[model samples]
Target: MDTLQFLIDGFAVALAPQNLMFALFGAFIGTLIGALPGLGPANGVAILIPLAFTLGLPADTAMILLTAVYAGAMYGGRISSILLNIPGDEPAMMTCLDGYPMAQKGKAAEALALSAVASFMGGLIGTIGLILLAPVLAKFALTFGPAEYFALFMLAFATLGGITGKNPMKTVVAATLGIMISTVGIDNTGVQRYTFGILKLYEGVDFILAIVGLFAISELLLFIEERAGAGRKLIQVGKLLLRPRDILHVLPTTLRGGSLGFIAGVLPGAGASLGSFISYTLEKQYLGKKGHFGEGDPRGVAAPEAGNNGASSGALVPMLTLGVPGSGTTAVLLAMLISLNITPGPLMFTQNADIVWGVIAALLIGNLLLLVLNIPLVGFFVKLLSVPPMFLLPMVTMIAFVGIYSISHSTFDLYFMIGFGVAGYLLRKLEMPLVPIILGLLLGPEMEKNLGHALVISDGDWSVLWGTPLAASLWLVAGLGLILPYIVGPILRRRMRAAITEDAVSD
Candidate 1:
């Protein structure tokens, strides 16, 4: 009953005219951003952070807009996968297996419609799970002390490499670099660590600049290097009608995929890409020969779409409840909250109930808006693909410069952002995962603070780090998180790659 009341009040906040308008606009723009290949939800959110600040949006309104963009981007990623044989983002890779085949068969419209429906169902299921589970998780988290939190942060770092990158060692290097960057400012004891006699360094590296540089600006450089959006033919969407039987045919697959995705999303470091891959793989195995999973089967289109979108929502659970992001995009969103001076954790529910509930309500509303927009306005979004990269690149670069300048009004920050962008490009060239870098930056300071608190309480006794059962259990999990990747990563990657190759050859 209390949850119900809170939800109702949340609806009240989300339905306000200004908030509703932002949600709609965000959904519209996010779909355009997602329809483009190579630009994903993380970039979409990072590119828009300046706009939120420029407009001076309140905490709740900004969250509603950005969350809507996140959800919208998830829905829009399938458009290119189905039509262009190119995934709009990493998580959408599974969608291309059958989606492109359907398009090649002149069923592009049907594929898009089916994916839209699947995304809606998946997002809905995830949101309902969040409502039921977040409060409970928050309550459980209230019992945690500094020692438990330190262990929890370790678990996050340990598991991240397994889920997000091909090489755990490289992930560790990236994370260490980020932590080293984070340590550049004045410490709690008023001692400078790495200021290097520069006054600006006293405040440490501003994560906003780093995020925009790493995600948006670096992506722009990659686009230039690859000459993306060069000559490519788009598959024509034959008809806009979806058969009712097709919906019924894939309903079960969608439900199962959504459920599995939600669980995956709840686990730290297991993100949408994993959810989609597992969903498609499991459904293929379950149905065996009869399913024709990769050969333009509607179930193939539904399963991964449902899985990834569900995982996107599920990623919010740990982020809101435990201050740990479950996915890359959620990490960006976590940065948004931190920038707003809104700490996400157990107390968030009691201390900032309106913001939490309102954001939740906005997600529900945004999902509905995405469903409506994706099906009918898909043609408009697909047209976006025809716009050459030459035009888009400059526009994005302009936005980054203007947005960053507007926020800090500092010329030095602009140069610093460009430096990070160059560094990010180099990291990408080396095949290093960028999310771990952002996570390290976001969580490093907090981890240090908690470790300090625990040591002070234990009078410098190192054993207190894992003295309690909860802390010890977390440490055990962290060790497993590190070791299991070596054991499981190869098998999983090989199977997924084989599936992709098999399907592409079949088509």
Candidate 2:
């Protein structure tokens, strides 16, 4: 039977008015959640998981709603990152490098519109790839054992750490703190490391709460300080339409980033943030001094938006095909599937083809809907900044509190969120990048788990890390990622300096 036939059938299932309503509702709410600082795709989906059941939707229909929200949240995250110099989510952090500058230059509409278009293209590419490549990729991924997994995560850390922050050391420092924090809770072996006899500490700090504190709460503090004396001037929103030249300029970058992000997403543990950051780094290197990558270049805005959205969609590949959750959001998805008595493995394709393909169809439709919805609403979103700081700050803070409380339902988490908020503010004052911290928090435990599994399989022989071709290649890449940044940094600066000197002479 042709795969196309299954896809067509899937669309029939997804197009039901009830399922369509769920998808649209998820997309709308997801975008709103993503636009708020610190609340992201994971938080949005998690928040809505119970609602899906409450609505008495079927398991497949519920997943359609959650996944649509997942995709929509990723697309919406750039709104804050571009407009406020504050990332709406970890994946959106890369967008801020260029997006905020564009906003400051009165191109908020153009930046947001471009982001929406790029996201649509990326998500479309990813959903298509998922349709065609999931089975093949899933088989390949099955070969990755604990040793290979460990090596892959090391590569992620090295590469991600190398590309972020003004100084690699500072990024490393933030990452180290995150790792330490990750270890604070009970280990897989059942020993609590830093619980301090408090029952609530057994689970350690919540990554979601940390994100809310670090991005949303700290952002509020910074906004207040900025408004302490002279009121801030808001950037005027401009026309939302992009010129033909603008579209043409970003098209190639978008395609390249979208492809790269899909590949990254297919890999376990490599989520949207890593995909977007790596794409941004590659674009910066390729453009060299010409791109002005961190200075409002459209290429800068296009790359990460495409990458993150593509990665977000790509992350579903492993979950659907192999029953392996690739990222935090997908992990939540896996749980939801299990709760509904749906097993997600190789046989699932044959046994539950409708559920699988219906999700894929819904994802594509949701991306199309996001592009249609976000573009015309660009002006309305931009107007959110026009509110007075006194009013806006309280509202934002309260939203953050409510979001965290709703998820954890603990007063302890609320206080913990505030503490992390102060820490986030202080880190910002020290010029430390928060991206690495989030990455470390996400990856550290995964890395340790893989390492432990590898050791158990190899009787604690350390050389097992490089025992296989895949493992060795990954280790080599990790080594290169760690060293190459230091080597390339000085050389790039020298070249940029020479180019500036030549330009000055010509002038």
Candidate 3:
């Protein structure tokens, strides 16, 4: 009953004219970015961060805009996968297996419309799951002490390697670098560790500058290097319409995939990519060749579309209740919340209920908007593939420079941002995953604080780290998180790669 009232209050906040306008604008831009192969949701949100700040949106409103963008990007990723053989992002790769084939078969419109509906189903399910689960998790989190929190942080780092990248060692290196970076500012005891006499160093590297540099600026550098969209022709999107029978056929698959994706999203370290892959793989297995699982099957298009979108929603759960991001984009969103001076986790629900519920309501609204917009504007979005990188890169660069400059009016930050961008490009070139670095930066200080509190209570006893049952359980899970990747990752990767390879040969 209380949840019902809170939801009503949330809708009141989200329905404001300004919030609605920003939501629509964000949805539009998000789809545009996502349709361009390689940008995905993380880049979409990071690129637009400065816009939110420059506009000086309140916490809830800013969240609403970004969340709308996030959802739109998930929906838009399918556009490229269906029309062009290239996937718009990693999660969209599964869509390409069937979507591209369908386009070749002249069912491009059917594939696009069906996938949009599936995405809507997944996103809607995920939002409802968020509304139900976040509060319960937050309430449970209230029982946690410093030791439990420290253990939780360790669990996040341990599990992240498996989810975010192919190699754990590289993830460890990146995370260590981030932690080292976090130690730059003054310590709680008032002594500076790595300031090196620079005044700005006292405050440490700003999260906004780091995120913008790593995601937005780094992306620009890569775009310039690849000379993106040199000569890609879009497949014709014939008659944007879906038959009733097609929608009915995929409804069960959409439901199952959405449910699975939501579960994957709720699990720490299991993100949208995993959600989509596992959903498609399992559904294919369940149907066992009779369903035409690979050769332009509508089920293939629907399953992954539902899974990834559901996972996108599911990722928000941990960020809201536990202050740990479930995926890369959510990591960026977590940084946004922190920058706004809003701490996530248990207290967030009570202290910032308006923000939490308002964002939730906005997600519901955004998904509906995406469903309405995707079918009609998909042809327009497909045309975006032909847009030259030269034109787009400069605009993105200008936004980053102008927006960062507006915030601090400091040339040093601009220089620092450029340096981070260069470093990010180098890191990407080396195949070092960037998400772990961002997570480390975001979680390092909190983990340190919790460790400090626990040590103080235990009077310098190391055993306190695993003394309690709850803390010990978390440590056990962290251990499994580190080990299971070696055992389970290989099989999953092999199967997914084999599927893609088979599809390529069939094509």
Best by lDDT: 3
Look at candidate 2 and tell me the lDDT of residue 116: 93
The RMSD of every model to the true structure, in order and in angstroms, is: 1.2, 6.6, 1.1
lDDT tens digits, residue span 1-507, model 3: 878888998999999999999999999999998888888999999988988988889998999999999999999999989998888898999999899889999999999999999999999999999999988999999999999999999999988866675688898999889888888889888989899899999987798899999999998899888866564777888888888898999999999999999998888888898889988998998999678866999999999999999999999999999998999999999999999999999999899999999999999999999999998988888887888887778888888888888888999999999999999999999998888888988899899999999999999998999999999999999999888876787777788899999988876
The reply for model 3, stretches above 4 Å from the true place, is 229-231
Which candidate model has the greater TM-score, 1 or 2? Answer: 1
User: Considering lDDT, where higher is better, how would the candidates rank from best to worst?
Assistant: 3, 1, 2
For residues 163-248, write the lDDT of model 1, one tens digit per residue.
57568789898889888888989999999988989999998889999999999889999989896656467888765887889899
Regions of model 1 farther than 4 Å from truth: 228-231
Name the regions of candidate 2 deviating beyond 4 angstroms: 1-119, 162-166, 227-362, 485-507
- Candidate 3, after superposition: displacement of residue 333 in Å? 0.4
Candidates' TM-scores? 0.98, 0.67, 0.98
lDDT of each: 0.90, 0.78, 0.91
Whole-structure CA lDDT of model 2: 0.78
